[model samples]
Target: MRNVMILLLGLALCFLAACGANESTQGNNGSGEVEGQDEAEPAQNDLDYPQKPISMIVPFSAGGGTDATARALAAASEPYLGESIGIVNTTGGGGAVGMSEGINSTPDGHTITMVTVELTTLPHLGLAQFTYEDFKPVAQINFDPNVIAVPADSPYETIEDLVKDAKDNPGAIRVSNSGTGSIWHIAAASVEQATGAEFSHVPFEGSAPAITAALGNNVEAVSASPPEILSYVESGDLRPLAVLAEERSDALPDTPTFAELGIDATIVGCPRGIMVPKDTPDEIVEFLEEAFMKGAQEAEFVEYMETNGLGLVVGNAEEFGEVLAESHNFFAELIPQMDLN
Candidate 1:
């Protein structure tokens, strides 16, 4: 009986050793197959991928809002991604060029695009060759409320005065918008609808140029976010008439909102988010979302948004997708009403 018990104990010890060896092999190669056995390779880790530098394509000109946001996000995400992110400015066709490039790129997870309000509105207006379905969302970074401003020397002193002028002269008062179907243009249209007015819609490549035209007195008024016109407003070069939001902007609290005047028009501003080609691997999207969420929470990003009149709206991939879906539906309904194409 003693011999039999010793033999059983030895067998138990051998079984334990075999299990240990299997685990050791699995740990070394990340494949659970036992030594000398053949099996499919285990899933890959992100660290093993993107051996080359990544690229972030900004669908607008350099130094514009999209470019700036792209750079900020890249700076924040590079350390976590373990690779350098290259930013390429491919501007034209109201962001269609860069967006097309991003969509066509291999979805292996190295390419992403920084898009804003147009990402939602352009499709409905027949402007976007590719819809939101073409891109996989990563995260949202900022939400900027559109503002209405006029030349400092313009006769209009209030939003009411501007609306009255537009009402008095339909399609006569030239108004500058960032682009067709953009949030800025939507704000402009909202003003026209609320007040039953008409203004000649003048489109520009981006907010910077639109605001620049306003400052240069090339246009009677400009529709852009506070960030694009803050300095001009501060320097007395431009006068902010009102913000197209439910409440006044903290940056321009004294400036009233369209609602204050009994115009039920509330554009609620617009949010900016990050996206990659639709076919990018789910794991890569998660990797990017995690990195960006971490960067967004950093004190620097928060301070930057606060100082720049941009509202920070950070969300994970799933949450961002919901926001995108809602915005997509909202714009799909809104563009037809605006009669923009």
Candidate 2:
């Protein structure tokens, strides 16, 4: 009986030791740090870039203006990047889904997203959980100017004519855009503030569908990127009313700008840029910037811009980041006034 009791005591001691070890390990894991283990992994940025295929996420759906822009940019950048560049479309929640994916991506520089004016407006509108600070800007591709377009047979010939009708009809004039707080939507808002005109706002899935609605005469007007409406304008299905830039578009040289039309605000084109998670290595970001800056000037790229009716305003990472900051600040102020929540 004495020997059995001693054995039981020994077994109890061993069980206590095992339980203590498990509890200690659970505590360490919950704390997310191992004792004496370094969390910061050293990585050099200037190393040979694109050791593998790069992935670019386009937040908008395929066949839209943003997706087209992504394809052209990917094509232009692949040779310089020294790897196959793959475009992944992850669209939902008015582009917030793909943006969330971008913000949560690994910081190895292998993955990034093409961000548009939505980058500025999403957080301001409370549609996005992450803000511009969550990203590290890589490079800016171009500015996609918003152009006002109407059906070819519409009575309104110019921007002034449209504004006159809007003023008289109040909310009778129907205008279509991709979504609330999108660049096109903001352009319409700017027009309203400038002219004190009112119109019924119609939101669509993306610019293509919005342009299609305008083409089908479901909406009186559409505010979309030049590429979205260019083909129809060329085919005489739509009439170009005005370009939102300070200057006219090269694609439509005869068109007038909003500034020329005496609008107080310049809607100008929203710039599209590339961004990675905020914690990405500086070297990887620099590598991508260098590649895109050079690739942006290629003749094929210029042809792509012309073919798509987009303006290429290529800039390096720092300049792009500055532009992004300015846009973020601008939308942060503008959204509140428009009551875009």
Candidate 3:
């Protein structure tokens, strides 16, 4: 009887030891820690993305078309993103300064930049060292077709009349653009290319200033978007001669397009979009694309765009990337021909 009791006690002790070992192993695995050691923290991927507010850098001064677009987009996207998107303008170097800041930001998808058509031309003009390839496109929000406008009292009644004057007086008629390498400037260059005329090109800091200069009669005409001069056109302060688009704009349907006039000037406009660092995770990029796309389709956003005379051109990351590549290639070929380089 004594031998039997001793054997039973030994068996009970073994069972207890097994239970303790099992518990210890489970605790170590669950807490990711060993006995008498600290626990390991979770990995970065385990955390929610956009854990903080996003910063959207606009490489232009306030009140410009790009700034307006950025504000509109940020306002619209904040609801969908569940966080605020702050717009920070770091102007200078014809967008180079802000662009560099955006490009050099941490690639964690928290910082993005509002890119314009200038991304395709600035590098070719020796004004920037980076191109569209340097950033990963997130979404394309708006596109505004360039319009040729003159002061309401100008003698030129039609686009043909303006072209005739330009040809007759080469480098005499002064034409103003937003900046030397801006999309507005490219529009003027396209006009010069198609009509084989030479007009003295003047550069301003932005579209607002360029249009103001034209309204004040400082320049013979202004190459800018219809929206930029909408108030002036409505108030009889400016007369729009032509729209450099393949089709007429809804905002200014009465204005003729360069295509209808047999001019081969197409694709002269500003395309506004968002871009992030190229190394951002695909999942994060996808999330942003979906969120921004939803924001773009929101009714308030559409109304704002229409009211402001800006066209809503929404595209996801892949589509935007394709557009960027095409624009870059087009400029790469056209810049040399226009001697802009």
Candidate 4:
């Protein structure tokens, strides 16, 4: 009986030891699985970022330069983004309404805005409560330089002729711009600063109307993009005197730049780019930058810009941010000096 009891106790002890070992192994396996799951969670989250469609807001009406560029970019980026990008035109307040909507978006990378050079000027003009700094830049798609254009039958055939006439008769040469505190207005002001000439700056609702005013001989000249006046120039209704760029545009190879004409303003006209709300996630911004950069380089997009006389300036987020900062600084000083505010 003593031997039987001893054997029973030994069996119980062995069983307990085996059970404890199995429990320890199971606990370790569970902990290992949990650690592995934790490691994968972040990567899964990263991949899940843009799980829906995106909305791109254009602040101008359809058929304008901003709208055209926005559409091109959205189309080109859709394939790479694995989702469709819908363009929404929220035109008003000189682009303030659309920009405000973009700024006030959820910052989840679904909502973005096509920003223009007006972004730098609108705040100074009291047209918007936000500036370029209010949003995070994604990429710069285009930079169409402002062109000094006049009626086809105008006597001012060149920049020199226009400046000479304007200098001789300060505030007499009527130069029409898109609006009072618009990018074209700043271009007109820069022309005056460079040549010591004064133009009777006439404000229109937009570039189309301003160009129309010049074409109808209501204004002596129109400061606008090459694309804005390309058809007219081709149709012999308008003559481009000079482009406000450091170099000549391929779209207008015959047209000289401001630098060629001894004018020093290198950057002018409307620079259109993409941006999201400032607090958007860095990962999302990076993804968008990559996608848009790829989109800007697409053959179809390049061909469209070239055919339309639009300047192609492809840049990533950091480079775009730098350009925006420079533009902001330039306009900040120029606006005050020109009394645009």
lDDT of 4: 0.75
Q: Judging by TM-score against the true structure, name the best candidate.
A: 1
Give candidate 1 misplaced runs (Cα > 4 Å): 1-47
What tens digits encode model 2's per-residue C-alpha lDDT throughout 266-306? 35356787999999988888878767665665556657776
- Decreasing TM-score order of the candidates: 1, 3, 2, 4
List residue ranges in candidate 4 displaced over 4 A: 1-52, 264-269
**Candidate 4 residue-wise lDDT, 170-199, digit = tens:** 888999887777888888888887778889
For candidate 1, lDDT tens digit of each residue in 1-341? Answer: 22112112222122223322333211223242223332222223644666778888887767556666677777766666667899998776667777888889989878788877677777777777788788898987766677899999999999888888889888778888777667778778877876788888788777778888888989999988877777788899999998876667767878897767777663635667788899888888877776666666555555665576665556567656766676777667666777442
Candidate 2 lDDT for residue 236: 96
Poorest lDDT segment (10 consecutive residues) of candidate 1: 3-12
Separately for all candidates shown, the number of backbone clashes (residues 3 or more apart, or on different chains) is 0, 1, 0, 0
Model 3, position 85, has a per-residue lDDT of 94
Local error of candidate 4 at 2, Å?
96
Q: After TM-score superposition, what is the CA distance of residue 321 in candidate 2 from its true location, in Å? A: 0.8
Alpha-carbon runs more than 4 Å astray in model 3:
1-47
User: By summed lDDT, which 10 consecutive residues of candidate 2 come out lowest?
Assistant: 3-12
Better of 2 and 3 by TM-score: 3
TM values, all candidates: 0.83, 0.81, 0.82, 0.79
Candidate 1 vs 2: which has more TM-score:
1
